[model samples]
Target: MTARLDSVEPAVRDPIRIDFEGWSIEARAGETVAATLTAHGIRGLRATRTGADRGVFCGMGVCQDCLVEVDGVPNQRACMTSIDRPLRVRRQRHGQALAAEVTALPPATAESLRTERPDVLVIGAGPGGLSAAIAARRAGAAVVVVDERRYPGGQYFKPLAVDGEDVAPPDAQHREGLALVRRALEAGVEIRTGVMVWGAFAPAEFTASDDRGAVRYLPKAAIVATGAYERGWPVPGWQLPGVMTTGAAQTLWRTARRLPGRRVLIAGNGPLNLQLAAELLAGGAEVAAVVESARPGARHLGALVAMAAAAPSLVRDGIRYHWQRMTRGVPMIDGMVVAAIERTAEGLAVTLKNASENGGHRRFEVDALCIGYGFEPSNELLRALGCRHDFDAEQNRLVTRRDGDGRTSVAGVYALGDCTAMGGARVAAADGAVAGYAAAAELGLPLAPALEREREAAKKQGDRHRRFQRALWTLYRAPPYRIEQASDDTIICRCEEVCFGDARAALAEGVIAAGPLKRATRIGMGPCQGRYCRPLLEALLAQGSDRQPDEHSGFAPRVPVKPIAIRDLASASD
Candidate 1:
């Protein structure tokens, strides 16, 4: 029996009685307490540290924007949580409740920041987002830019300290990004650092939560340039503390000035792996070996051609660096893969397997193993919003619809940078500029001819990059051996302590599907909310049960769908 979408109507039922801040309300069953209160016109669910009013911003779970107390727990994101049964809500000022007690600080941390509504809310402050913000502000729209990182640079341009002073240097493509962000800041863009817009919903509401406390923003239009994360191949001991993805290692080194380990083993097939090896070696870390899964002669031939033709200087520099490494006795091993890893007191004992040989392996002592196949779009926010997505089997990511401009299927909501499609920073910054100009035009702002021409040029670059990306995806697709890496004892969901054996048992006992397995074992319902574990679990189940990965396995759908504070729910009916 297939569920008919057209048969369901939007109606409230099975009311649950609750009290919020002295007000009595009847919340329908299966409705979030926040949704019930909002329906009853109850605003100001929680108070700021300065005793100011606040409410939901991002409707999704990531932002932690709609945090409130339900029953007794404090600091829960209201949007991600549901209001089943009965919930008590209370108003918690910045320094009034447990949050205050936890920090035991003056109100300055909570009260000193100014709050204002902007006409345009940009979810990321990357190159594309910054360019869009600057254009909007220049056209007389009050603009606010929010980013999860401490600094404004997306992946392309990073902030560095020179002579003990913070400075931003423009990489090959980030130079233009730096100029755009500087222009926006100069033009009065209200930039919020370390703020993540986790959820966006109808009626123009969004939620954001940070160390400063939860804040909600209402904007006329919003742009999503949230970018992407590195995709790690599933393998044994991947969850080990010393095993990090290439991007994670890069972030640690570049942002925090911390090395993941003294001796590193770089594995995985991609140009990025080579780039990371170079960076790690340059940063004074010992590179034990560079193991590439691809047969270099066959896979990198086209890339070599592209490198020589498009970026000869980069090619020369890469050759020179590799030569220096060889001169220093560093070895680059091809046609090899990391078979497994064992944690030792020293660090990690990694097993290396020859790709061409059967049952051939060697063990190497290493402090860290950095692995990443490539990049994938961060689509958690988009998926939560009911946006249509298709699985790009090659890249292992959800695909979004886009036109010449960066418009997604949802009008007034746009995606740019690697989040839309994977390319390096140069393409991302260029796409950001195009999205900015298009968004500005839609907002009734005039666009300069030169900017329009620049956008046209960017499209050409994007096309070329897309072709290159496609070739890379086909060449370095996850090998069949990856599916066999899951041992029976390998933990599937770290948050819930669910393991491969547990999931298999559930399947054998007629749990049968992903949804049922999740319900029986609570595998995907942990605090991370399945972001980190869902894909891997889905893949494993698909392989084990002979089912499609996208098929509903049997996870229960819960309201607020995320962790929420008990106090805010209690306040709504007070």
Candidate 2:
């Protein structure tokens, strides 16, 4: 478990008592259930169907690991739900079982659902969505942006605590995100937070719901900037209570001013890991080590030149982060990976394996282990809308297909940001501005002359960001993933707890595609909707043989793309 950092100023001192299990814990007003529990030295919030202890693994609402029964409502995300008053929370063991047979759709009366018509609707409240809304509204189009999070900034710009508005801006990124949010609000962009866009119908019709009620949006144009979630690689005991993605830990510190643990070990294959390590160090955590799979030294000097040339500030930040570890005497274990994690009496024992042929190993005992391999686009909405996509071999994932201005195969639909491709925040913002202008133009909204110039400028800026990302990836090159490296007993499908052996057996049955394999084993039927395992399941197809992704390689997204309450479904209005 973790504790609040004393260095970080308190957001608000108003404390509320929440009864978890039988213990009454004091939590700051407006703090999430996850943060409150963590601050009070409680991490394990639930038990999987198989009775494995689970906690906040993804930190976001995506993973569903932090499901806690809040005031009797089961399956509430601890990280997303705040405690504004005294409450009784419980560690959820299992959900209520559903009936065996399907029945008719629930009746959703018009009076219960709130509906609206807008010139443009933007999904997600990340940089891309906010930029799109600002641009579209500036171009004289009525805009509405919906996000599942409680705040405007996405993962990149994790907002201050809900009651932390009075706190000083922590960094330039925070200031920039706040400025962008302000700009969007000033432009009259209607942003609805804490609302989940659960389903999308044809011709850009969308349905969303929050705690109060559901909303249906009919728009002339809709921009999808749902962004992406980090890819969690499966290893032995990876589903332990204290293990989570690096971003999850970072979000806890950034927004709630709490460390995952006093001692933390981070293992990953991207610059984000380094950024997290640096942030944790600054936030008063004992970073045992940073296990990076990439070797970036003399072998990558050539790539560094191009990176510095393209984005000098970002390169400088990387160098600073690299040095911070050195001066602090934190071991920056290069060319190594986290092979496995096992729970110990105190915390966790992590095994680090070398990426080279020498096969050296190291181990560390820490309170938390953070794993962040890479990312996969959160494309459920895009897929449910029937937008076209293509498999990107470099990233080893299916990326949504979009044109220069983020237009998709569907006439009125658009996608951008990490959802369409793995471009960083600036790249996504630039792309979003261009898409917003394009959508406004199509809607016959009054276009400003300044917008055309800004759009062109954004295009050029995006080109630079892309070049920098390419160079950055080159500098931090990762070895190809081989599922054979993992133990046969390692759980592949985290939600279902399906093992690698189980998948191999299904493969032996001649099930090569995603759909049949999903049926053969209940792999993709879990709450995460296979976000953690589907790619790895697909990777099983090319385990030894170099198989490629066919048109049917990926799983199809159905309605209620994300799990939503049936009550919410029955009460939606437009």
Candidate 3:
């Protein structure tokens, strides 16, 4: 069993008791139902179809692994739902809600759906969307900002739990994000939180839902800053209870104010892993080790030199992170990858193998494993809107077409932030400012001279950030052979329980692309809508056939980017 920190106090003064799987537990007000469960070391929130225990893998609403039946509603995202009153909660199995008390409980009627006709609608509340909304509002355009998370911060600026001690220390990036959000609100931007945007009709029409039923926003322009999700890689035992993505682990500490486990292993191929190690150390969790698949060599030298001359602050930040890890006695191992994982008698056992040399492996035992190779932009909304996109080979992803000012292929639509490419916070903010100014100007709002100057300056700053992004991609790019490390028996898609062996067999039987492979082996047909497995599976198929990722094509996403309550859909009006 996992242990939780009893020393830390709950954020709320007033608390309520709730029933969890027949066991009553104390929960604080303003705490997410998911956080309440984690604080008590309840990891197995649900069980899969194969009888495997599943818990909070992404913590965010993106991964449906944390679904729980709340008040008789089936398939509710526990991480997004807050505890307002005494509620009956039960663990879900497959798609079944197992609460015995739920006998013909009717859906709670919500208030009339709020409709808005803002001049400009910002799709995300992170640095990008906030900056865009601020700029647009300053130029006299009525603006509204919407985000899926309850908080205003996007992933990078995600707000920490309200604890006595600061969950996150004073950082420039966090400060900037907060300042942007404040300025946008002061500038009269209407901010909507905890809204899930399901569908987008071209030319600025969106169908979304919140606790208040369904809402539609008919804006003259829209800016998409919906950011990216942590990329998932397949390996044996990845479906186990203790396994989670790197972002999920960070969310555990940052949002829930609790460590994921007593002992944890961090593995991935990016700078985020280094930062996560430092974070874990601060959160009072034992860092077993950090395994980095990318090896530092001459290829990264040019990018490093360019960044040093262009953005010394970014370079210094990286140095300071490593220094913190070194002082804490955390081992930073490079040129290594997680070859396989399995549940042992003690806990989760991970096999670390050399990325450069085959047949070399080392074993480590830990209670939890946090793994992420990189990030894939949440481009489903843009794709579903029919925005033109082309593949970027070096980045190993597809980016929505946008000019320097965040204009997309479709008119009245703009794409910004990491979704455009992983350019971090500063770059996203700069680009967002430019987009906001340009959008306002296009909408017939007269921009002041100072705002115009700021727009130009923002463009120049965005260039520097883009340079840093280029260096970042060059420095920690995933090796081609890393995907080949998955054993034949490894489960690739946890949603459908599709194994790597079955996918390989389908490829061997002349399945050339993702479309054919899906039909042959049911790879991408699952509850997650291929959010977790499609990218890795597509890469594997491409590598097996020696074709590029774009040649294999991408998965077509359907409406409702996230899973919604059936009652909410029924309540939505045309």
Query: Which 10 consecutive positions of candidate 2 have the poorest summed lDDT?
Result: 1-10
lDDT of 3 by residue, 1-574 (tens): 0101221123444567889988999876656788788777787887778877887787677778888888877687787777768889988777565354343334432234456788999998888888898899989999988888776778886565444443444346556656666677678888888788888776667888876777778888899999998877677777777778888777766655667787889998888888878778887888999899988778778989988877898799888888988898888888888877888876789998887777679888998899878888888888878788778876778878888788998898988998877788888899999999989998998889999999999999999888887887778866744568677888888778888889889878887677778888888787678887787777776674566665227577677766665556556432
User: Which portions of model 1 show Cα errors greater than 4 Å?
Assistant: 1-117, 135-140, 161-180, 298-300, 310-321, 355-358, 471-481, 544-574
TM-score of 2: 0.94
Top model number, TM-score: 2
Evaluate residue 403 in candidate 1 and report its C-alpha lDDT on the 0 to 100 scale: 73
CA lDDT scores, all candidates in order: 0.60, 0.83, 0.78
The better-scoring model by TM-score among 2 and 3 is 2
lDDT of 2 by residue, 1-574 (tens): 0111221122555768999988998876756899888767687888887888899889988988899888977889999997779989999877566443312346685445677889899998899988888888999999988888877878889876644544334677777877788788777888777889888888688888876767788889999999899888788999999999998998888777778998999999989999999989987889999999999888788788988888899989998998998889998888888878899999999988877543688989999999898898888888888888788899777788888888999988988899888988989998999899989988888677888899889889899999989988998887866677767899988888899999899898898778888999898899899888888887887776878774357677877888887667665421
**Model 3 spans with C-alpha error above 4 angstroms:** 1-12, 26-28, 84-86, 97-115, 165-174, 297-302, 508-513, 544-546
Alpha-carbon RMSD to native, per candidate: 15.2, 4.2, 5.0
Summarize candidate 1's per-residue lDDT along 273-354 as a digit string, tens digits.
Answer: 7767776776678989888776756666776676566546556756776775676577888778887777787878999887
Q: How close is candidate 1 to the true structure, as a TM-score?
A: 0.72
Candidate 2's C-alpha runs over 4 A off are 1-13, 95-106, 109-113, 162-169, 356-358, 544-546, 572-574
TM-score of every candidate: 0.72, 0.94, 0.90
